[model samples]
Target: MVATGKKLSLDLRVIELHTQTKLAGYIKLLQNNMRKLFFGSKINGVMALYC
Candidate 1:
């Protein structure tokens, strides 16, 4: 019974680590999207002025 409890604890730790990694990946994706959006708008504005 004690061994089973220890195994469960190890599994929980692994899951928590995975969750943290996934969260970081999501944050990076969001940052990239925001950067692209800002850059896209700037380019659009310049094009409008030239056109």
Candidate 2:
């Protein structure tokens, strides 16, 4: 019984780790997209001013 419990705990830990990794990947993607959007907007604004 104790061995089974330990196995279950390990499985849960692996699942948690995978979930954390996936969430981190998504966060990084979102951050990159946001950075691009802000940078593009700034460039566009500058171009409009120059025109």
lDDT of 1: 1.00
Q: Write candidate 1's Cα lDDT for 1-51 as tens digits.
A: 999999999999999999999999999999999999999999999999999
TM-score, predicted candidate 2 vs. hidden true structure: 0.88
lDDT of each: 1.00, 1.00
TM-score of each: 0.86, 0.88
Model 2: pairs clashing at backbone N, Cα or C within 3 Å: none
lDDT of 2 at 35: 99
